[model samples]
Target: MLSTESGEVNCITMFKSCLRYPFHLKVLWLVILLGCDSNLPHTNEEDQKGQTALVPQHKFAGTKTCVSCHTKEYQDWQGSHHDKAMQVADSRTILADFDSAKFLSNGVLSIFYQKDNKYFVQTTGRDGQPHEYQIIYTFGIHPLQQYIVAFPKGAYQCLQTAWDTEKKKWFDLQPDLDIAPNEWLHWTGNAMKWNTACADCHSTDLRKNFDVGSETYHTTFEEINVGCESCHGPADKHVTFYETNAKGTPPPLYMHNNMRPKELVQKCARCHSRRAQTTSFFDYKGHFLDHYDPSLIITPTYEPDGQILDEDYVYGSFVQSKMYQNGITCRDCHNVHSLKLKKTGNALCLNCHEPGYNTPSHHFHKINTEASQCINCHMTGKLYMGNDFRRDHSFRVPRPDQSVEYGTPNACNGCHKDKTPNWAADVIVSHFGETREDHFSDHLLAGYHENLERLHELISNKTYPEIARATAMYYYASRISPAEVKKIEKFLNDPDVLVKNETIRAFSQLGLGNYLPQIKPLLEDPVRLIRLSALEYVNKYEPNTQRTSIYQAAEQEYMTFMDMSADHTSGQQRKAQYLEAKGDVTGAIRAYRKAIEIDNHYNQARMNLALLLYKEGNTSEAEALYLKVIEQEPHVSYPHYMLGLLYHETGKNEKAIEYLRQACSRTPAILRAHYNYALILQQNKQYDKSIKAINEALLTFVDNEELLYIRLVAELNSKQLQEAYNTCLLLVELAPANPNYQQTLQEIKRNLESN
Candidate 1:
């Protein structure tokens, strides 16, 4: 049995091992090379089993040893946020005034206090109850410090509130926002809830032993912080070989000698990526799918340019950059442990780029000024999470010409919000004297902008790079003309899979056409995503022959992919959505169930499966699945709304009202839940309550024709005929083409005249 201190020491040793090993060997298997030595006892059997003994205890060398050789690096890392990322909140670390301060956000209340110089926060919980908890840990030191609250189930969630280290106060993240009272899962929940999702990458050694039966987590680990070993592999063997060998002799360990720039990138990508984990980590070097899952869906996580959005860090953004393609590693600019830039601000870029690259003459501006900074002109800043300022990492050139061509924001125009892109373009032209034309202007700007006709001609010529053409196809698809549609239809047979995929996506947006037959062949495309895209396209417009063909192909492909060693759960979910849209609810349900089997935490598939079950009158099963979904992700509102509807359908009005209120209180999808609640109130003859619910629904959907009609009826029933008449007239004006709106307006007018 391992004592707590022994466990901590062993974990530290493992972390050291991580730093010593090469990045590639760590990602792949290192035991295969090192554990196969014939001189070691039981080496043959161990080699066959692919197992290695625990590294010798004497070989362990802590960060202190590293400081001797790299003094400057050690000093920079000592006071860094990474060093104090996870620590016990005390007089020194706890920035919040915990002596006597209370905060109330929505209906949830939290009280902060200190006992024995240790900080703690007490808050009202999900059960509408108050609980006091000692703050056992803190995550992240700079920017904010998140506290971990203890719960009976060992559950924790990162509180939306954070300690403002500079201001010395606890601030609510959503103070002015009107979130519902029941939405406890909003960032205010205990930090433990997000641990399984994020803590692994941020911390050193994280274990998630979540038990579904009792809904409890017994997660434990050696370190509460991210260390060098998190990115690098174990270093114990390397240390051993170095110390045991003579001073002049070469070490016998395989270091990261061949880790080129690209290989180094993949290592950084493991955490800095905008991907989903395919599996959980049972041990180091576990299979990706077996332990962690990654999200591949087109959600808010990705930008329009296919860069990583604001969800995680800027890893995806860097990958799409010219710097990365030209060979730039994370360590080239940023220190490993301290995680700060090697040089400050714009000076960092000057290390590689010449001073004249953005000199006064080159930038058409005076040098040694605020505006002269390359980042200011190229990477525009945006406000995120209300107060946080972040710069775009796309590293795009100042394309003022394209800005005027399209409506895309340029760095120059971004700084001078009052000035037009054309104004910026004119300034550039004046300064540079139009010596050179824009290199990518034709395809990037003029082709997609002022010269659509000429762009169409160029696209049809097919002399450009397939990627460039594919990019043009995306822009053209957005504002598709009849001629452009025809031109794109011909490219369904393009050899480039990207072009073919874009063509199919574009063609699907145009109304059903003769091109449906031509696009049918892509349903059996070699690429799984392309096939999925084909299925999506057919389901949208031409759902007759094309839909059936694509559906069959998708099913076959799904089975083929599943039967193989690789898991494509997201692809399966896409097929299920297609089946659902095609009215094959049963088939869709099976596909969704299979997707859930592949990844139990896939909330989208699980929710869809539950909704399909509800539609098929499988209320009991649907209810079970919905509860499970809520248990996993209480933040999601659809499950609660559907559960409320299920209760209403089964004649449990009281339960329906409770769930409906919860659903409405939690998310922006409150209109549907409020409307349903109004209907239930009307059925119960609660006129005043029904009117109130309808009014709330109306407020949420001020311009919605259906909602206006519903509000008018509710007002009329409540003896407010004049108000109903006015609302009816507004609805008719807003939705003149809506038959329901016209009928309601006429009926209300007749009733008013009769009265």
Candidate 2:
């Protein structure tokens, strides 16, 4: 799923998806239609935090109720981003060019105009025809504002053309795309749908009442925009306690009353971070991962070095920062109520960063210049959604050296665009010492290259962020050595929620094995994400036991969470995979199809569906599905590898060789591609070519047993008796237990002696 769930995942701060499983770990959610949770591990998010949830039945008193008591905070938030996050589509709120402005993007023309004192936009609708739709609402306020129009089945889509407030013009959020109307990423499609993607973060207490039976949303929210009750617990109890002065538990302290850095960051992370919603809406209770599973430092959202490559709001980046580790919160830089910087430029950084950092001697740049600014050097940003420029908050030191080696971005190249990365690296080395400080990205990049030693080191190292370590472990699950398995198994008891969640997930991939006893305890874990992973492991791998009630309850909770995001292809894909794992092939097939139907661009679903179809004896359709994935992603090796396997199974030897060759030539280095291809050649009596293939492949996969075996057979068939004899000897050494191999070696010896 690592497309960081590679295209297997994705979306926006306002999300989009497919059978895209959020690997870095974020996706859009539908509604979770759960019946009961009596036997479930935990009923509330607060169980993870050791607090009983108090606001489950709490009433919202509205922003008006809080105005009398906290006038300053209320006024500060009046026109703030959160207050203007969402608003009715009136002249006062609508900021786009409505005087019949014509904007063209790659042959698609979008016209913004108004009639009857209402804002309207004429754009390509779902059927690929230009349709005029009245704008129902405006989304967000500052750098860019998107328009929302209601559609059938409770659908609300945000227009692709957004008002570039700073430039005072209309621009397409996604540009230069020849998107078909049926495509998921089209402005009228599910990717741009506000109900599924944008509404959760933009509004207050959003209940995304998506009905799975009808595929509709009856979405409701307590307030129009993010208001007081959104962050601070529903104000009714707070107002009652204050007005009546009847304090028992003291209104369950406001989110920021005496907030720690961690608490403050988590509260804001609901909207700020790229994450998947596990429930209907954000409830002001429990751990962050309980309601949401946040995106980790995964690509294309994040570079391997944990630098921001995509629009990864703040939470994901901040959590990886040394500042966060050292206890820096959002409030330290910006006011909680106003959402404005407390200090400007270098001064804000100087509050914590040494004064020495501000001088040219330290920065090696002119004073008061953009290059000299702390943010430019450290918080290099990317321009996203056409014009919205958000900076990376990871606060990492510029590593030009790593950039030169890894092709990752660095602060030097961000400004010195004309200069090569090598030049930047040399310049950095000349200024700083030759030795760069050790960072997790180096190990992460190495791990991608099958560097097992670095991966093991990174996982064991607690100095790096737990998210990075967990991500490393996620990759390590497949490559893990038996000796190192116990080392990783120890992390199942890790206190860090992410590390433990990933550890359980890793072991689940490896199977329960001897760790079943250790893993069974995590079924009752405090964190929901952790418990879910643990439950998945025990439920799948463990033998029938007396804990049927406990198992079923956890299973139901898992299903309910899976059901929540069933609207998106990613959600359906996840459910499909889980069903497939549990031995429900028919159900899994249905779910996979549903996922593909959600988004045709969901190649993960296509690949999985194709695989299932082949297994189910529906070879023709499976072949077509494989072709469809190849059509969508011509360059990717996975679909090609699967197609090759299908051809091999069906005895289409020529086509099998063709695709296996393609698989071997691709970047992923399909593990058995060379062996499979050579086997087919040998089977087809192309002994010389089979020997040639194995000889070339052996340069890289020097000791691959299957490759060696196939080469031995090809050599024996072609009458290269001495070569075959040597190959058999190597095979015998590689696998002595195989009597077939033992007998074959003796036969080859006799043949060699005769020759």
Candidate 3:
């Protein structure tokens, strides 16, 4: 009785569920029906509608083609870091002094010297013996150039030894790092693996075809370095069309080049932002883990409260700024090719802002003075990684009053550390009087530090700008009481997606179960991130059963959305997360790999995949991945911790102790590393050193019950009975309600009585 199209649809549906055909065959069948046949009748009204596919008329112009016209831009880019982000190692590219310098770290000895002006390195092999290798590639050109030391798995970490171009001498990066004697200095150590980590982002068309069974990588790249094609799409068609056809005849083919400012920012943001990697490069849209997900990685890259504690360059902070909403692009204030500010100091601000606000009269400072500089006041500078000076890109106005009230630093206090905030505030008042007492200036000085009641007053005051109110709302959201949820909920419908998203984050933090019902509707919101936030809040607050129907529907919708658009970078990352959550490891790994294919800098995805590999007992593959992570981020601590664990599992206690100690020294997640180190020390029968590590663990984590028990055991094993008994008494008193604490206390008491 059904129509012809309905009959075919029914047959396909039956085939999909038949379990006879493979999944690929079923997918191919669906594609054939949906894409090829336009005459099919629609059973559902939605299926009847025709969707427009984006087809660009113009093609991409390769960098070489552009070079003919833009000689200046081309010349400026030739030797820059962006141009040489990846390069095959050679006499010209290799920078390390490989012939003269011999050094030892921990116990691993390495010798670097030059012969025939070619760099060469000799170091301990992975098998705890001496080995020599010629440098085949050099990755990165900046503060340092990392040399590729080839090994069985892949080209391992670039030696910590870098050629200081300006200084003209070899500099040891891990000067204080205690590497074990038997450990390989570069290849098998905690640092210097590039295939799984740095290659995806630093190179163009990088393919890390890791053989899971062999634990080796056939890493290859179409381009040795990031090029014009890295951001702009491949220009093969554009080149052909331009070379063959006249300008009037037909335009060249190209990827979407007419992106709005937001879209353009997202392209730069893909690498510049602090996000976790969701996939591998060979799998999907060319995304790499840790290099792609800005939100997940940025939080940890910075201090707990979101200050730039490390060297995370300003992408995340800029997104949170009002400037981002004002249609600002990275190119607006920076030279993309050179990767430098458009203009140095105050001149950059004068390009957009009128000189009126920045003049000495406006700033209440003497003209032509250092204090008169715009960055000196608005963007405070901080020192990181020993001597690297970086400016805070948050672009917050100086709030001397807030500095005094909440003990937070202000630009005024930053330059003049000896002066109190009160002094700075009094100076401003004395010079400018009430002229600068406007609401924005006032709030900047005190609103963020104000009580919830005061923030509420500001939010309801209508006289204040929405931007200021929204900023205050974000600050107050952390301390917002349950009663205030309704008031904040009103902003959820605000025209600004940023405001609405912030509201959702605030409500999520308040832990209100009732908000789940209200938030559930947002799962169908137009924005993908909003829907993600909604799902996250629902999962956090509402019970699984209560939110089951909504969760499943939302998840299915998100998955369908990902399937429909393979080019959306964030969508692919989310799909991987969803698959992983569903306990589909194989599917999740595939999705993660696909994300990396979309964007190669996704480091978080790489880390997750590595963890999964480690869990699956693929130790060699896991070790390679961990080394890659360390190469990308030398200062990061997770890779070292993972490597320590791997070494410990393989009975390399000395190597484990070395890496775990490095991890504990650098990262805030020190407890686990310390615990493992203590165990390693105990196994070596170094009782004093074991007690020392346990004591350090206790200093930071006194309330950790498991650590306390471990310490008690360490003390007993070391024959420190009196100290163990005393420690047991403290543990019992601290955790009187815990049965294990009581039992340990009784045992210690019996031991004391016997003694």
Best by TM-score: 2
Count residue pairs with overlapping backbones in model 3.
59
Candidate 1 TM-score versus the reference: 0.55
What C-alpha lDDT does candidate 1 achieve relative to the native structure? 0.56
Clashes of each: 33, 16, 59
Candidate 2 lDDT over 478-514, as tens digits, reads 5453445776878887767888887877766554356
**Candidate achieving the largest lDDT:** 2
Clashes of 1: 33
lDDT of each: 0.56, 0.75, 0.57
> Lowest summed lDDT over 10 consecutive residues: which window, candidate 3?
26-35
TM-scores of the models, in the order given: 0.55, 0.87, 0.55
Candidate 2's displacement at residue 121, Å, is: 1.7
TM-score of 2: 0.87
